[model samples]
Target chain A: MHAVRNIRLCTKDCLCLYVCPTGATDTETGQIDASKCLSGCRACVDACPSHAISLIPAEFPPQQEKTVSVKNALLTLAASKMDQEEIASKLAETTGNPVLRQLAEALGKSNRLMAEDMLRESGYMLPQSRTVGELLESLLSEKQPADFPEAAVKRLLELVNGNTMQEGKASAFEKIDY
Target chain B: MMRKFVCGICGFVYDESLGYPEGGIAPGLKWEDLPEDWICPLCGATKVEFKEQETVIPEEKKQSSLDEEHQEKIRELSFKELSALCSNLSKGCEKQYRNEEADLFRQLAEYYDSKSSAAFEAQISDLAALIEADLSSGYENANRRAAAVSDRGALRALTWGEKVTRILSSLLSRYEKQGETLLANTNVYVCEICGFVYIGDEAPEICPVCKVPNLKIAQIQRG
Candidate 1:
């Protein structure tokens, strides 16, 4: 854990500068230096008069997974927001009234933000995390349609194995439908 | 006599079944009976800016069995097919000047491919090789498409997407180090509107991230 300062609440008492053993709290940016600060040390956090400093863990716990139903609902709402954003964008472009156009611009931005938030919540925003990796693996082993892209899978495997340089040769996998 | 009106500016719905009690509007109030000067609580838009929208009652929400079947159809696609679909979708987004969304779709495509490789790491993975080629080609296409269009709104959205992706990536790294044992002990709740996660015994009265009421927070079960 490292102590971070909330500059808004920081009183500039400089108490943290005195308490911090590694001078991590004495940074010019008013933020904690995670690398310099010792692990689990909360000396500055305890000494801060304004309570602006708090210890944040280096590692965060895993986020819980949403059920399929909840995911579907969120995705549906995201699609609706995307539609609203597109309409607002068009209004902003074509509206004759300046005031109405400004309002439309604001609405377009707001709708986009809302849609992105929903997408983040739906797990698409996450990178290749371990949980997602496991889920993907499970999906791949299952039965697939006749037109499933087997060549794509083969190419992906070669890339992961660091054999991308030898991918020019066409293989029989591309000819197979199943 | 209950009617629904949606604010054109912010999509805030004014349903007479649940009137704006905070604004002193009583339940069962007709849309026409609303004070002509009344503005949308969300975006301050006047009544003239409100449009009548189709209201889905609670009972009608139950009649979405067809939607469920549609979802099942999507779920039926194999991982390889899904990755291909995601890659194609990313290319489509790139062409539309949605750089941020395009990046996200690309990340998802990479993720699905990574999973396949991880699952069959001992074997010669054909999927991994294909995804590698696609990744390089996809980036080249996205870069070319982004240079052709210059929309401020798209640029702003792209910035926001990058910020969100960075935060989520940090969280993922943290979780990887902490493991599931630590997470199992904490109670986790997800925001229904924004999907923000909160860890605690009780949900916050208001979501600090989105400012939504705690009524939307739903607890997830730990394995």
Candidate 2:
């Protein structure tokens, strides 16, 4: 875990600067330098006056698979938001009045953002994540339609495989050849 | 006499014009006339969880349709409501042990809450202006926060959000610049699964973001 500072609540007390053993908190941008900070060392987190700092894990575990019910609910909500966005976009396009058009555009944008948020929450936005990779793998292995974008899936697999190969090479290079 | 009711839990809007026949609710049925035990057909949320669409006025009373004051009020109320929804969603993510997803929701909640303040500051009655501010802050914060945590899923989500925001921003700007000329030439398709918007003559064979087939992409018609 590394300490992070929420600049919003930082009071410029400089307490973190004084107590840090590695001087990771002594930054001009009010953000803790994660590299210099010791692992699990929360001296600054404890000493901060405004409670602006907290420890976040350096590595997060793989996300758990969402239940079918939750996934269905999220997709439904996403579709509903898309419907609202479509209405707002159409209104924006059709309206001649500048103010009304602007308002409609804003509505469309907000609805789209909300929909994207739900997509992220439902685990559909992470194409490069393990779950997504696994999903793509399964899809590719199955009997897919002729127009199922097989090339895209293959490209994704290549990227994953390339990453694994690079990592393997790096580990091999780290070994001391006797 | 038709009014819209929005589900607080899922953002589902029940339009009187297209009454939820799936829920056995007949067309033209007033929201008040619905049974006391009625629930959201989509999410099963109780009647109490449904809020009337605050800014929508009847079509016959077109003159009373969203004025500046009403627009500002609705904008503020919508931010508050969106924040509440984010909070609920974060709790749900936490229940599933999806920490990164939960964190993203918390960040979204913070962004929207802060945006409500920005809206108040700018007195932005226009929804597009509010959304611009939202996307600007959302991507910036997501980039910064995602770096501090090593969640690949969170990072990918943030990157995707940024890309989509950029596309939408450019599209909206083009619409603003060209007006009806642009609208006349192009059609808008929305992905029903993930809400990815595509603007062109036809929908893509597959969604670039969600990878869903074109069947899930529905064209948004302009009347």
> Whose DockQ is greatest here?
2
Q: Which lDDT value does model 1 have at B199?
A: 45
Model 2, runs deviating above 4 Å: A124-129, A132-178, B1-223
Candidate 1, residues B1-39: lDDT per residue as tens digits? 677887644457999899899989998888998987576
Per-residue CA lDDT of model 2 for B113-220, tens digit only, reads 554432112221343454465465544443443343344555555544444444455455655655556556656666655445565677777766557788877776
TM-score of chain B of 2: 0.43
lDDT on C-alpha atoms for all candidate structures: 0.50, 0.56
The 10 consecutive residues of candidate 2 chain A with the worst lDDT sum are A160-169
For every candidate, C-alpha RMSD to the true structure in Å: 21.1, 20.8
Clashing pairs in 2: A106-B127, A106-B128
Per-candidate interface C-alpha RMSD? 20.3, 15.5
Q: How well is candidate 1 docked (DockQ)?
A: 0.02
Indicate the worst ten consecutive residues by lDDT in candidate 1 chain A. A158-167
